[model samples]
Every structure is written in C-alpha cells, then in structure tokens.
Target chain A: MNMSRIVRSTANILFPFILVFGFYIIVHGHLTPGGGFQGGAVAATGFVLLLVAFSPDIIRDKFSFNSMKYTEALGLLLFIITAFVAIALGTTFFFNWLANGGIIFGESVAFGANPGILNSAGTIPLMNVAVGIEVIGAMGLIIMYMLSGIEGGNKE
Target chain B: MKSKEILTAIIIAVLAASLLLPSALMVFGSPQNDGMDSYMIDNGQDIAAVNNIVTGVVFDFRGFDTLGEALVLFTAVLGVTLMFRRMKEDEEYEYE
Candidate 1:
C-alpha cells in the first residue's frame, strides 16, 4: 500500500535518524537502559516505516534477502566465536575473560555507582553489537517476507 | 454449531482460569527472596567492569543464557526463511 506524499516524505526524513538512534542504543547497551534486541527492533521499525510508505519492490531493491541472511549468520558466528575465544584464553566457556585485564575494552572500573565509560566492558559490548546486528537482520527479513506475501504485493 | 459452542465455552473457561489463577497465586509489587540479588549488587561491577547491573547479569554473569537465547532467535529466523521460500522457480530470492 502506497502512502500519501506527506507520509512518504516524513518517513524519508525520519529514516536515517531512527537508524542512528538504534545504533546508539546498541553501542551503549552496556551503560544504558536499551540493548541489542531493543535497538534492532528500533532499526526494523524504521525499515517498516519505509516499507509502509513505498512499494515492496523499491524496498527490496535497497535490501535483498540474501544480504540480511548473511548478516544474521555473521552476527551469530561472531557471538559464538567471542564466547569460544574466552575458552581459548584458559577461562571457562562464555567467561568475561577480557574484563579488567588491561587489554582492549579492559578498563578497570571503580567500585560503586557512577556513569559508565564506553570502553570499559570487554566482551559484553562486542556481544551486544553482534546480537544487535542479528536482531536487525532477522526482524527486517521477517517484515520483508510478511509484507511481500500480502495480497497483490507482487503486482507492479 | 455444537463444536463452536463448545469452543466458546472452553475459551471462556480458559479466560476465567487465567484471571482467577493469577490473583490467587501472585502478590503484586513484591517478590520472594533472591540469593543472587545481593551477590550481583556486591560483585557485578568488579566482574563485568560494567555499570549496568542488568547488562552484567545478562551478558557476563549469565552469558550462557544469552547464548541460548541467540541460538533460539537464529533458529526462529531460519524457520521463517524456510517457511516463506519463493514458490516460483524464476523468483528472485537470491538463494545463492
């Protein structure tokens, strides 16, 4: 279903901003109220807005099914490998081996309540990004599938 | 018609059971004692090096749970993709 010009223009205006907001939520998941899944859903909502405004053919041209599938696979793979690497580091499986160890993302945290540093958490942030990517891909693909499968969606 | 009446009755019974069971079983705004609460409050920051307790709990302290959840989502996505595969041979699904 094609939206009016006003709705379409508003969606065009709001699309990138929503994407940026979603990324912000994902990146700051360790320190903020939002996280990977929430951010990914937000991103998917932006895509949905675009889909509602434009045709499925147009949206499909911008984002194909294969790209999203591969992205989901890559995110899951990254998450698994990150966990296994902790095992490789002589820690137990899914261990926070990088925390407070003075490596990358290994900043020691001061005890007690305060605003958190972005670079403090080690594997958590990495995992958050992975999960965020996975969620975005999965939700976007689902929305695309459902929208395209609707009656008369294939016409024109 | 008989089956529809039975289904409607069954639905009402289920709805009543759900509504009544929750009121009888749960106490609002108060939870039972939790051992992990105090432990995480004390040591979560030192372990995860992160400020948010929930994030620490989900991604660090109980990371295996997160892993399981991720796998579940992956499986769901796979199921959706498979279930909605293109019907036409010439469809542009990009399986490759």
Candidate 2:
C-alpha cells in the first residue's frame, strides 16, 4: 500500500541522509558510541521508511530477496575470513594482527588518552563494516518477507 | 476464582520483590569484579587501538561472542524465510 504524496516525498528526501548517517556510524564505530549493529539498524530503518511510503511491489522490484541473501552471505564471509586471516598469519583466531603492524588500519595508539585515529583500530573497523552489511541485508529481508506474507494474506 | 486472583497477585508481587531487592541493595557504578573492566580500560587502546573500549572488547577481546551474535541473527532470518517459503508453497498447492 502506498502512502500519501507528502510521506513518500519525505521518505525519498530523507532516505539518503539516513543511509549516510548509518554508514558514518558503522565506519566510526571504533571511536563512537554506535557500532555495526546499531548503524545497520539505522540503515534498515531507512529502507523501512521507503517500504512504508511505497508499495511492496515497488520495493520488491527494487530490492530482490535473492540479492539481499547474497549481501548477507558476503558480509558473513568477509567477517569470517578476516578472523581466519590471523590464523594464517601464525596468530590465534581473532587476533588483532593488524594493530600496531604499521600497515592498513595498523597505526599504533599511545597508551594514554589522545585524539581518536581512524586508521588505528586494526580489524575492528573491518568487522564493523562486515556486521553492518550483514545486518542491513538481514533486516531488509525480514521486513520484505513479512510484507510479502501480509500481501499474500490480503490476496486470499 | 477470587482465590486464584489473589494467588496470582501475590506471586507477581513476590517475583517483583525478588527481582528488585538485589538491585536496590546493590551499588550502581561499581561492579562486583572490576579486574576485567580495569584491564580493558587500561590496555584496550594499546591492544585494539580503538578509542571506544566497548568496541574493542566486542570486536577484539570478545570476538567469538560477536560472531555468535551475528550467527544468531542470520539463523533467525533463515528461519523466517523458510517458514514463509513453506507457507507460500502450501498456498500455491491449494490453488492448484
């Protein structure tokens, strides 16, 4: 079911901003209060807004269930692979091998309080991004499934 | 019926009291074990290289737990999809 023009317009206008903010939260999770899960939830809310404003058919056409499934699998795979890379590097699983390694996201942090650095959190940011993608896909798929179920029920 | 209502009320009150008594008696800011908390706070930045201790703990020190949590969400979604698919199949079969 489509919403009023005003609601649809507002949703269209606000969706990009919401998604940007969610990505901000996910990317800066190592330095901020929000993390992958929280950011993904926020991004999913944007999708939800669009879903509510437009009809299920429109949303379904835009975001297929198969695509969301792949997105979630890709995110989970990335997360697992990141964790396993530590083992390949001769360290224990989930070890912060990148931290202080002077490579990507490997800038060593001082012992005491200082300004937060974006490129110093090792695999935390990577994991955050992975989880964020997974959450977005999962949440979107769940909402879409429920909406489809409702639509099917209405058809009967 | 009146006695059952009274019993239910009493049970609820007892449960509420049991739940609240410890919280009321306990301190708010201080934890029973500060060892892990202090260690994380002290060395989390050096180890995980993140300003947020919570994130460090979640993604670094306790990474396995986060993995488990992610798997839980994935499983829940999988279950929902499976249930809906079954329902859709049944509906289509009925029509045929």
Judge candidate 1 against the unseen true structure and give its global Cα lDDT, from 0 to 1.
Answer: 0.85
Query: What lDDT, from 0 to 1, does candidate 2 have?
Result: 0.89
Error of 2 at A45 (Å): 0.9
Off by over 4 Å in 1: A151-156, B1-32, B88-96
Every model's TM-score on chain B: 0.57, 0.68
lDDT (Cα, tens digit) per residue for candidate 1, span B2-34: 999999999999999998996788787555775
Instruction: Give the DockQ-based CAPRI class for model 1.
Output: acceptable
Q: Which 10 successive residues of model 2 chain B have the least lDDT summed?
A: B86-95
What lDDT tens digits, residue by residue, belong to model 2 across residues A1-156? 788999999999999999999999999999889999999999989998987789887776688888989989888989999999999999999998888888999998887777888998999999999999999999988887777776532121
lDDT at A30, model 1: 86
**B65 in model 2: Cα distance from truth in Å?**
0.5
Locate the minimum summed-lDDT window of 10 residues in model 1 chain A. Answer: A147-156
> All models: lDDT?
0.85, 0.89
Worst 10 residues of 2 chain A by lDDT: A147-156
